[model samples]
Target chain A: MANDLVVAPMLVVLASIVAMLALRPRPRAQRVASVAGSLAYAVAVGAVAWLIVLSPDAPGAATYQLGGWAAPFGITFVVDALSAFMLTIAAVVGLAAVVFSVVFVDRANQGVFYHLLFHCLLLGVTGAFLTGDLFNLFVWFEVMLMASYVLVAFYGGPQHTAAGFRYLVLNVVGSVLLLLAVGGLYATTGTLNMADMSRRLADPAAYGIDPAPVVGLGALAFATFSLKAGLVPFQFWVPGAYRSAPLPVAATLAGVTKKVGMYAIVRVYFTVFAGATVGISVPGAAGASPLAFLAPALLVMGSASILVGGLGAIACDTLDEMLAYSSIGQVGFIAVPVAIAAAAPPGSLRRLGLVAALVYALHHALAKSLLFFATAAIRSATGTHRLSDLGGLASRAPVLAGCFFVGSLSLVGIPPLTGFFGKFLVFEAAARQFTASSGLAGGAVIAVVLVGAVLTILYTTRAWTRSFWGRRTPAVEGATVRRSQVAVLVGLAALIVCLGIGFDPVFEFATAAAEAALDREGYVELVGPAGGDGA
Target chain B: MKTTARIVVPIILVLAISLLLQGHNLPGGGFIAGVLTTVAFALIYVAQGLDYLDSGVLGQEVESGAGVFEHRSVTAFRQTFMVGLAVAVASGFAALLFDEPFLTQTFVIVEHLPLYHELEFASALAFDVGVYMVVVGVLLTILSVVGAE
Candidate 1:
């Protein structure tokens, strides 16, 4: 049953790849196959989520041994609440993207294996989420990156090529750093299995290893993940990459790919190195955990990202460019909760932070995909994504305008939308931390997040009003909007609204995922030996 | 180039087959074997040209065959690649039907064989063969598609 949880998605991926390869020369067949494949993948992911939810065990994590080999030696796939949740989100977004691409992508681009690469990208992401070992996570990351490299450069234009090249180079550098960190960790812990590594790291001194180097390696791993997630000081490539990518591909990358990075950070920080301590030594003081020292830095960076991204979005002229910048800010919002989650002890506060992060991630995936899909339709209808060249789209394509308006409102965290609940949760968590800690850092995080939220509204409103309102421009006069594309946007918008209205169940789901994520002992027990060896 | 191809292609093919066959027990495996086979074909293409591959040394009838190989190397490789992927996935699914985890391998031993006393057959070998075909097909597809341009 556990093996089926992992293999189901993989089988969909493999079957999709085969279908694409077989039907490559036939565009119509390829489109149908890709859509069907994506739908099947979504169903498989849904089943996996259902299985995880129905598990009798507390925390709900199931570990599947590949080829019947046990963990700490052979590959294993772990489907916990968090992983299942992420998988479901990814599959849903992937399905929407693929379906949109059937008519959204031009014929020439479709011929160049678009469907094949899309499925490969999903495979990589799902594999990353489910993998139980660090090395396999890296492998999955590479698979994801490889597909993205081509997708970013799908148009074969000069700007697209340059943007793709920068994306490639930066990601490759991040990969190398990750590999170095993984090597150092394996050397110190003598294991690549995450649970085994966690157990070993819990008492490094017993293994004759120094804790400082291990802590440093963990920081390196965090830095690499931050780079992948497009955090501040490492986000130079994102705007270009997002701006130049084919619109649907950009939607998938922003909606799904960057969250994989965030997932890795959560997995590594909370699970693999959950026990490391990292504060200054005081003769009579209790030792502080590494996450305590790391949290402030992450908070500062997260705050900086919000400021930079929000300001950049306000300053950008093009619609896609603004959305790209908005992505950075939204990611920063997600990061705020991540920092709090990492810093807080295993309690309600920490769980709140984790839940906030998960909710924010879910909101961002849907809202951003919706926004980008709307951009695709707008671009198709207007023949440009430039804001100045487009106006009065509401009159020409009222459905698209309405979808974009709803998406923008959700993105800005307006009331009664999914994004508002996400932002509200983060604020509540930050306030809780501030009250408990009464520290300057916690207060600052709360302040910065508040400001970031305000700025989000300002920028999203500006982009919305500038593009969709006022007198019609020449560019919008004779543009044709495809019904299928509009349907995708409306569907996502409807989901956003539905989830917003039914926030209690969704929030509870996210809380459960957070609980599973923070259950270090439960994870170790499931993936490692019980009351033996390292235990 | 022709002299080099004449001397190297046959040896490469033989080496690839040996590697593929022994992969189940030895360090040599389907991936390397497939790569080696692709290298041989690439060498032939570089030395003897696409025309040679289509209708020359391998013969027109061989190229025009209904199964597997085709006159157009790209199309043939594409088909081969898809088939290989399907086969690989199907092999994994085979275990699921038997109430086992995916990609599970089971061995069957035959006793009192004609030439040898016994032989062991493993489903993993079939999976490996699928992988081998995929590797060769992908590499050739890239080579032929890029080479044609």
Candidate 2:
């Protein structure tokens, strides 16, 4: 019974998708089932988290082998603290986005495979988070991208179609690269199961494996992940895709799917590849592990993403596009700490770096999704998200504006809010790295974070002042906000506030997740890949 | 083209069914078989027309001027896709009911039962059939819709 809980989230979502599809002709019933399924998903995720990682007698990690096949032969799903924490974030944002979608999207449009695709997206996310095979990860990524490709072009207008096409092309290319990398890895490492690969890579001599090809293969894989995470140089698709997609779907893209990329980075690099003892000669990165190769590259990309995303956000005219750009920068915030953690030796500083990254990711997921939901609320009320066409929403719709205000303040990292701790922990990681390392690299990271924080404040405030304040335009004045949409926004806003106020447990959860992420031995032991030399 | 398609389509479908049935142990499987079946359909559509399956084969009156989405075949294809998904997921859940891991499969061999003599019935065949349905449904849907476009 306890073992069954491991796959419960995925099963619940699959059932929801089937139920929704069965009820496709009945829009009302389908909508209700969608919401009910989302609720069930959240509950299933909660059960997984509690039983697998959080309970007093919990093992802190559990693995379920699909088809009764053991690791190295079967697809494995590992529910560890890291995965559980990430799934919790997905559940929060996913439920909010789905509930918001039911109310915000028109009935006619909702009937056109909207709920179906949305659940498919969730299903993909769940599979990606749980699966322990490298090829399975690629499969899940395709599953996720396939659903999103349609949702992005759901409106089927010219701009939407164009954006979706570009998104599809770029991701197809990314998927190809990912497949190449996965194939290359299988050839190089002789296994696709991450746990088995890690074990083999850890003792290459015993396994007769060459660790050199992995360096190039790892970079190839990293590029695809960076593309998925919407990091710099690969961030071009972010704004157009987010702007074109339905607002709630955009929220899922920004809040949940982006984190899937980040989660993959942490899981593959930190847990799997971190065990590979390889010599790397990257200048700033000094270690004998693949992470050493990752550190410098990640640092440069993370910093650039921060600057590029922030600058882009500040110049955006529409609220959706601005939030889209903001997410790129927020992902940078997540990536920077991961870079720092990759650079740092395994110790307290490393753990702190991971904790900072995880917390920032959680905060960004909540804040950005809340803000997107607020944008959806305003759009539902006023029929526009362009900043120039809107004004005095504060006066027109106080609750909606208030929800947006909370979201914006959280984005700006104001005191007693979730973003404050996210930013503070990130800064603390950089600052501590500065003192401990006594190197130019540490100083550079701190400088980048400081600039990024200021840029965050700048764009968030620009978005707030331009759209929510001043005299009411006709659109704003005539706006009639949907109560349910606003209610969803309010609920998310309340969760953000409550999480921020009661930050202790959240911090503890993040710390455990970080530890789990860095626990290579535990991951391998949990999965226990069979048919190996028992070394 | 019509003569060739008429001759090849049935053979291709038979081969596809063989591939699907032998999927549990042999080289061929649901995905390839599904693709082959779709290819057979594609040849027929190309030789005859999009409405051939409905107007000629199924002996139904074609509603002229109706969009491809309103076409009965397209709807059937979509339903096939949905059913396929449900079947695949249900097959996985069936394992849980039997106190096995999700997607766990088992088989039983019945000896001297009929003309087939020893017949091997594998649980994996159900999963393969689901995959076969999904692939055929999705490909045909895309084919017909995009073909119309």
Candidate 3:
């Protein structure tokens, strides 16, 4: 079954390369082939997700050993519930972005290997989700980043090039830090396999390793992921990159790629360092877990991200820039639950926190993608994305306006929407943890998250009122939205509603995945014993 | 310059082929061989130019030589790239047919050849061939595009 999981990414990579080569001169055929290829990739990923859901009683994850070699020595791919959930969302978003690009992307841009790079980007994103080891995760991140750099600079304007360069430089630094961390980890545990490393870290004395270096390395790893996730202080690149990129590319980056960073944070912190202790023992105090220290740090950063992103969005002039800042804010919301999950011991509270994070990520992926797609339509119709230049779109392009409205409401966490449930779960989880643990810090974190939620409404409402209902400008009155573009937006809007209204099954699935992620014993057992020194 | 390139190119081509053939037994492999082949073509382009390389050594006068080849060379590199990619993917998937994980290699020894000694072949050789084609095709495509620019 795990072997089947590899087929999804491999198919996309192969089909896209073939399509690019075979139909480069024929733009029409290339478009059709790219859409078909992506849809097929989505189906393959869906099948893998189905396989995971079918056998709930199955122990551990489904592991596939590449080249018939076993764990630690060879590359392994695993499809646990969490990976399957992430893969499913990535595929759905990838398919939607590709479909939207067919008409939204200008012909000039499409001709220059856009489809090829898009699929390659999908390949990287999905590979990151499925890989069972840290080294392969880095490889997938590189594959994803290289394709993104090209796509970001696809338009070849000065602003695009400059933004792409900043994105490149920042990520290269992140990559270096990641490599150094991975090196330190391998040197300490003598295994690159994530599960094996986790087991080794659990009992470092037997391996003749000091726990301090491992804990320090874990912090280094966290810093690297923070840069990738665009957490506060490292989020300056988001607005610039999002503002300059082509609409479809920006949508893909916001909707799918950024989540890969969040996924890494969850995977590394929860699975690798879950049982390992950090910090020093004092003469009179009980030994504090590293997570106790790390969790508060994450909460502080998450709060700062929310404040900066929300305030920045309110100050932005253009619709794209506002949404870019909004992404930073939403990422902070997702990080809040991660902090709670990490801080709490393994139990229902931790599970709740993890589930909240997953739910938030899913909602954000859908809503954010819809918003960016709406931006594409607005930019194409009005010849600009500046909010002040646009108005009265509700009467002219009702479907487009409606799409934006629905996406906005969802993003703001208005009642009976997907985002509302996502935020509710995180808030509920935080409150529950606070009461159960009797920690005053948890109460403060809850207050910060609530304030962040309110700020979300403020920024989103501001953008909504100005862009959709402020007044009818000349440019807005004359602009015409295409039917195909409207259809794409409508389709995404429909999914948001379905997720909101039919929240039970999705929530249940997220819970199961959270449990799978938390079950360290199951993961280690599935990966099996590492050979030789790795054991 | 043309005389020297003409004299050296064939020897380089032979060396590349030898590298490819001996790859399974030694350090020289598909990637190095493909790079060497590209270097040989690059020397031709540097000495005689794009038109000369595209038309082959015989020039446009030969009916089968210049016109047909020149038109195709522009698109041929692209085709080569895709074909190589497909081949590599196919070889990896071939293991799936036998209930094995992806990219698994299977070896066979053939002893019945009339003119040659017994040879050991692995499915990985096909994958290496695919890699060889991809490297050559991609390098050539890059060279052509850059040269045109």
Candidate 4:
């Protein structure tokens, strides 16, 4: 059972996917596998949740070594609170998307469609969570990208294909940059273990070494990560891909893909480059330390994303597209705390950012997935996805309308729900001010994020008004809330409430992870320093 | 493109680059190899049909698909990811021989053999193998998609 705890999730996804391989595909097997794979993955998520709940206070993280070799070498699978939290998020979101994919697949022969790409996607998610080294993380990320490329283009319409191309192309460019960063680090530092790299960065003081090289490396890595995370300037890829992808895929893309980027950012920057920003020079941003230079830059970018993403969502027609832009803004919210943390050694602003990020991530993940799934249900019933054509949906399909309202309200940051708390955390964090300069700037950015939340409410209410609040209209056959569909959405709604109501426990978990993340000692402490090598 | 040459371009590029990246202890290493592989995979579609030329030269059907091939037409590509993983694992194992950590390429006889150390070549080869598989897999994946269309 103990070993099964770790191995079961992978097996469930693999087995479900592989089983679909033999099932004659076309309409029957493909949908079955898509839904089944998702259900099984949900169960697998439960397995991990059990692990976290059962061992809440354990001192060390759970680990499994692939092929049984030790570190400084072998690929290690580490499952701490941090990894587990991210895993749960990915699994839940992924499962929801796969479930939606069952119905979204085009009518063409989809031979083993769910089997191959879905399995790869799940494996990549699993791999990303489990890997303890930098190279394996990059590899797993590509695995995710490869699967996503095929899946995004699965519909094969010209528009879908074009979106897929754009998504794939930008991500590829980012991957190249990421690859360069990782390889550069490995080449210079001589180690692939992330924990090892952090140790090297922190130990420069002990060796009395100049901090310039590592600082530069940290900057390059962070910039690549920012591109991945879509932190301003590099955020052009999000709207198209999110708007164009099939619904389930869009949900996961919004939730899982964005988080993957942020997760890498946190893993590398906080764990590896934590305070290297203490002394660097960049124009405009006053830095308490050189490393602090990135703070002003991140703040500017984060604030811009918050404003741009919020306003951008208002112009889009489809609910999913609107949410896509909102996602960009949410990313700004997530970055707020980290940027402040970078400017100051440690402060409440960073802590608040951590909470806001956690809640926002959890909030957006569940809410966006439900929204996307609800869109599919609505379209199938009404044969359209535009909000203009969506009035009177509540009267036609009351349950779905209710679900959609809940999702939208949460997204809008309605008080007492998860979104509000996430925003509250960000606001609190921003107000705390790390460095005097950072404090002033962060306070201003917090105000920007605050306004962005109001925009979020306005847009979401607009959607609710358009879709469910007007006169009753004829409903399409597949649009009514089917028991199966509602079951999943309801499950998500439950999770949404649970996270909001139970913020303290989850917040502690995220904060602890954030705190440990900021501790660079774990980076190299995990990998013992090599003698004059990959250090 | 025909299946035969679909397998060769990557094999060749990987071998050449494997030789080039062997100098990383001083400049470029695994990083360059990964880049070369990424490009090789992207370029694979144009060159895969060259397998026909290989078939003519060998007077064989040119079967390779990582699966058994009845038509012997390079079998839609046999890029051998297993070979790459094997090489990576093998290099990892060799590190054990020097009492070093896994993947930790111990530079034995570092002062002496300048032109080519077997392990350095071996390490670079391991990485190239990953490149080779990546190219073949991507090519095959695209081919499968195009063929289906």
Error of 3 at B86 (Å): 1.4
* Per-residue lDDT of A496 in model 3: 94
lDDT (Cα, 0-100) at A242 in candidate 3: 88
Candidate 4 C-alpha lDDT tens digits along A42-149 = 777666656543355544345544544566576665665566677778888877776656545444535535445766787787777667788888898899889888
Per TM-score, the best of the predicted structures is 2
On DockQ, the candidate that comes out on top is: 2
Model 4 / residue A25 / CA error / Å: 5.4
Q: What fraction of the genuine interface contacts, i.e. the true contacts, does candidate 1 reproduce?
A: 0.76
* TM-score of each model, paired residue for residue: 0.94, 0.98, 0.92, 0.77
Candidate 3 interface RMSD (Å): 1.6
CAPRI band for model 4: incorrect
Every model's Cα RMSD, please? 3.3, 1.3, 3.4, 7.4
Q: What is the interface RMSD of each candidate, in Å?
A: 1.1, 0.6, 1.6, 8.8
Please provide, for model 2 over B16-108, each residue's C-alpha lDDT reduced to its tens digit, 9 standing for 90 to 100.
999999999998888999999999999999999999988988888888788998888999999998899888888988988899999999999
lDDT of 3: 0.83
The segments of candidate 3 whose C-alpha lies over 4 angstroms from its true place after superposition are A1-6, A54-60, A278-293, A436-440, A533-535, B1-15, B22-25, B45-52, B55-74, B112-116
* Candidate 2 clashes between residue pairs 3 or more apart in a chain or in different chains: none
Comparing only chain B with the true structure, the TM-scores of all models are 0.84, 0.97, 0.84, 0.46
The alpha-carbon deviation from the true structure for residue A523 of candidate 2, after best TM-score superposition, in angstroms, is 1.1
**Candidate number that wins on DockQ, 1 or 3:** 1
TM (B chain), model 4: 0.46
Q: Model 4: how far is A105 from its true place, Å? A: 3.5
Candidate 3 lDDT, tens digit per residue, B56-119?
7544433344333244564677677778877877898799889888888888899988887688
Please give me the total number of clashing residue pairs in predicted model 2. 0
Best by lDDT: 2
- lDDT string for model 1 (A219-284, tens) is 788888888788897878889999888888899888888999899988988877777654455332
